[model samples]
Target chain A: MRGKYLLGILVILGALGYMVFGGLGRNLVYFLTPSEYLQDQARYQNRSVRLGGLVKPGTVQYDKDRLELRFVLTDGVAEVPVLHKGTPPGMFKEGQGVVVEGRFQEGVFQGTNLLVKHSEAYQAPKEGWTPEEVRKLIEEAQ
Target chain B: MLKTQTPSRPDALTWVFLGLGLLLLPLGLYLALAAPPDVNQGYLVRIMYLHVPTAWVGYLAFFVTFLYSLLYLFRQDPRHDRVALASAEIGLVFMGLALVTGMLWARPTWGVYWTWEPRLTTTAILFAVYLGYFLLRGAIEDPELRRKAAAAVGVLGFLNVPISYMSVKWWRSLHQTQSIDLTTGRIHMDPAMLQALLFNLLVFTLLYLGFTRFRAMVAALEEAKEEA
Candidate 1:
């Protein structure tokens, strides 16, 4: 009976230890914004990191191979040039948020791939509205 | 009326296992502290010392469940069924530790807390399926039926363990592959670190056995009380 009680106590203690120390296991990666990365550039240089921001307008350029691409990722304050070797996703466009993973080399962020983030407010077009009607409504709202 | 008393004999195997567990603590500590940091990953790689051992022991516990579940099905012994259930509970605890430690290690290395990588996702599913085993056992009232249902789940859940381990190799995943192979005695680590990891593995295995046996004993006692 005493042995059983001791076992119960040990199990309870183990459970409690898990609850307290478990956070160390869960939050392994800390997210950083563009400005945060810039502020700590010296410490983070040459290390693998993730950069997330909007694809700056008028900065996208595609190569002859159609697979190689370049774009500028901006967080309104500064823009970082990105060179990617793979094909960009369909939703990857100007003014869209994207997260790229790679190392920062020679002041340029060379990304291996791009993940395009879609907005939550996407709405389907009304069934009754024709293109002409929708154009008129847009004109009136503007 | 008086009850008859029989001579009680202590289980020597349990004591030996417990001694082995005690001996491992210092070795695991030595490995964690003595090994030089990795040239590329640095101190973060030390997390592997604890994480890998926990994962291995979790797999060991599940294997025990699979064997006992088969025994229960063939022999129709409630004792084997109780042992299987107790082992599953312990297995869940160790698996939870593995998942948590994997996440902690990933954050400093992978640049994200969670990813949709194949290995990580499959392990997560494996954890959930085993958790469901406990819930299913609780919801059923008939003891015989519960044993049959739980045995089926135990067998099926064990099948996922291998798939989780191999998912990294079989699919595209950001998670890294296994770093050490014990069978070939081929390990890539600072000598001190390898020693620490092996020590911790032994300690954790002892802890797993101790807990499972204790849990089984408690389960048996509870059943005896119910029968009374």
Candidate 2:
């Protein structure tokens, strides 16, 4: 009886293992870089996709009255223009890693959601440096 | 038929662990508050103190369940099965804590409370697998058959823990990579923050030990009652 039960469980588990690791593996690419998206524009055009890249410096244009934000996202090799119609996240800043979820319309990416990807490193601000200075230092490092 | 054994009470060591953990929890919280704010996230980064240790406890508890499940299979011991169940119960709670705390942290930083990222997906799956373990345990009417099947689930389900831990690295994930990388033994955290995190981890570990022992004792009593 025990052997029979074990065999039954092993069969069930084997099927579950295939579904989880095999079927889900293909869709595991969480986000695509600008380079990756541009390489296959036809495949992603009109379809909702997340584009991960750095916000290009000097390209962040935010109109507080209109709640419209525009920026150029770059992967150092390629760049994509993004237009978002909402207040940017507090962490959103120039030269920082970000993932924008939206569909491509014309030549620009229409962003529906914006997410900041923080680095793994967690350091205390340098002694006597203000928060604004610390922010600038981090952006400069990018 | 053989007589059933009486349920045993927690011994002195169990009390020591529980007392120590309860005593040290405040110290851990103090250390976390005293830890310096991050260069970028400012005081918002203090959430790591609760999030990391709870997640660590979840991983450690599941690993314990995996080990005890293997032991139960080899020795056909009911005691081992009880321990596995106890550990898994504690693991599920801690894993839920990790998930909740992570979402709270993600909102201000990532701009959303949740996403379909790899790390989050795999962790959700891991949590489901353990829930299934308990369901499997409850469904079986035959004691031996139930033990064997639940043992199988406990052994197989733990595969998700490592997958979840490594998901950030194996795939392009929005979730940040490990601050303290286990595979490379490298830490990317400030010394003060690291100390506070480590202290919390210790406190949680002690609590886990005590909780599991106490829970297993209760399981034994319940089993004794059922048998009698």
Q: Estimate each model's TM-score.
A: 0.61, 0.91
Off by over 4 Å in 2: A1-26, A128-142, B1-8
lDDT of 2 by residue, A66-122 (tens): 999999999999999999999988789899899999989889999999999999999
Model 1 spans > 4 angstroms off: A1-142, B1-12, B182-186
- Residue range B108-142, candidate 2, lDDT tens digits: 89999988788988887788788778767766878
Range of the 10 consecutive residues with the lowest summed lDDT in candidate 2 chain B: B1-10
Please compute DockQ, using alpha carbons, for every candidate against the native two-chain complex: 0.02, 0.41
Q: What TM-score results for chain B when candidate 1 is compared with the true chain B?
A: 0.89
Candidate with best lDDT: 2
